[model samples]
Target: MRAVRFEGVGRIAVQELEKPAPGSGDLVVRVEASGICGTDRHILRGEFSSRPPVTLGHEFSGIVEAIGPGVTRFKVGHRVTGDPNIACGLCPSCRAGHVNLCESLEAIGVTRDGGLAEYVLVPEKQALSLPADLPPLYGAFCEPLACSIHGVDIAGLRPGMSAIVLGGGVIGMLVVQLARLAGATRTVMITRQAAKRQLAEQLGATASADPSAGDAVFDICGPGGLLSGGADVVFECAGVPDTVALAPKLARRGGAAVILGVLRPQDRVEIAPLELLLREVRLLTSFLNPFTHARAADLIATGAIDVAPLVTRQIGLEEAPGVISEPPPAGEIRAIVVP
Candidate 1:
């Protein structure tokens, strides 16, 4: 088996390694498709926290090649998507039902061998069943979609409400669809890429704006602007300082601003306390998928969310290292690795 391993900061390679066998209560999945994520780049640049000398793919899905003892919920031939994030059940956060905030969280691909190889071991608790007929590539999106679902849930969007999604990457694109499904009647997407802006509109964004054209905040939230008095909910999915700072400002008075983006560990942004205080805006942040993986799988399997448009390209495991080592191509939403 060949796995894409992150040896250290600024180092990555696809090296041949022994295939994994399922441990007790684990499943050995033959990697079918894995999606390259921005976090992969962050980890390569040493911006995100990750244990090196491990496989680097968290958003993946595959066919079960073998099952370990006591794994009765899934069979050897089932198609499944792995949640990747594992929380200690005894942790305080887990006991309170906030598993994503576990005091000691261990994630696949980040801390353990992941699905970037020909085969990866997945604990039975982290594997969720997917439809056997679901497209292999689509299954790879379940992980990201699950994270987006958590963001949407935090937003608390309501019927006929307005939403502004910053950044038109895969997360933003998926957030747009989720907002609409959550009953957001007016959805606006802001991004520098014209191609992504166009795709967002096609994917249910009521409108799109170019952040580089001018002051995006005024253009979308100004009086008589797209949403007039700002959106009911604003989602910062770009994971950058500029978008993070602008997210709360795009929310209407008393509305909520949810930060779904993951920034570099050392990154920081300044916000106006007076402005937030005067407007009474709720500033919130959403982390990893806590308990939404199953719903995400159901949405993808039932064709409720359109993931086909989000897949920009596909590459082999041999080429994954290069893709992860370099910046994403212009307007590339997602690059799927077909192992």
Candidate 2:
């Protein structure tokens, strides 16, 4: 099998490797599609902790080629997507159903071999059977969708509320849909890319704004910087110093500010503590998918999310190296690698 192995910080190579054979309690999947994530970029740059020489791809789906001993839930030819967060069921977080916080975790792509190959092995506990009608390609989206679900859940969203998502990436796009479904009457997406702005409009964004220009939403979101009012909720999905720093000024008094972006290490943002003290706003952060794989798949299978629009490119495994190092244009929303 050929796999994309992460050699170390700033190095990833497509190397011909031995195929993964199912072990005890393991399921060997012949990967059909793998979604490239922002985390993959972090893996490439060595920003995140990943075991060296590990093949890196977590968001994926494939046919079950073989199953290890005691694996009875699935058989050869079953289509599935799965929970990438392999956790110790005995851990406190796992016992509480917050397996995303599991202390002894072995995430497929991060800690072990992932799906950026012809075949990848994972624990049977992590694999979930997809609806027969669901396309295998959409399975790659489950992980990110699960994370967005967690974010929306943490926002404590309610009907007829307003939301401002500060980035137009895949996560931001998914967040917009979730917020609208949660009954947010109006949703605004802020991004520099015109294509994303337009796509957000199609996905139920009431308004799209360019961060460079002054907009009234600023009054709602940029209160301390240049206005008197802020939005009911502000989600910082663009993980940048400017964006993170600006998030506080964008939330309405008593509103919620959710940081959805992953800040690079040593990054710092200057905030107005006194203003935050007066605004009564809530500063929040959402991390990985919180054991929400089931809901994410249902959301996709039910056609609540039109993932067809987000998939801009699909390439073969041979192209994985170049695809990861130098991605397509900014207009390319999502790319799927088929092995």
**Residue 185 of model 2, lDDT score:** 83
TM-score per candidate, chains pooled? 0.98, 0.94
Q: Estimate the overall C-alpha local distance difference test score of candidate 1.
A: 0.93
- In order of listing, the candidates' clash counts read 0, 4
Candidate of highest lDDT: 1
Candidate 1 C-alpha lDDT tens digits along 1-339: 999999999999999999997889999999899999999999999998889899999999999999999999999899999999999989888999999999899999998988899999999999999999888999999999999999998888889999999998899999999988988889999999999999999999999998888776576788778798899999999999999998888899999899999899888999999999999999999999999999999999999999999999999999999999898989999999999
Q: Which lDDT values do the candidates have, in the order given?
A: 0.93, 0.84
Candidate number of the best TM-score: 1
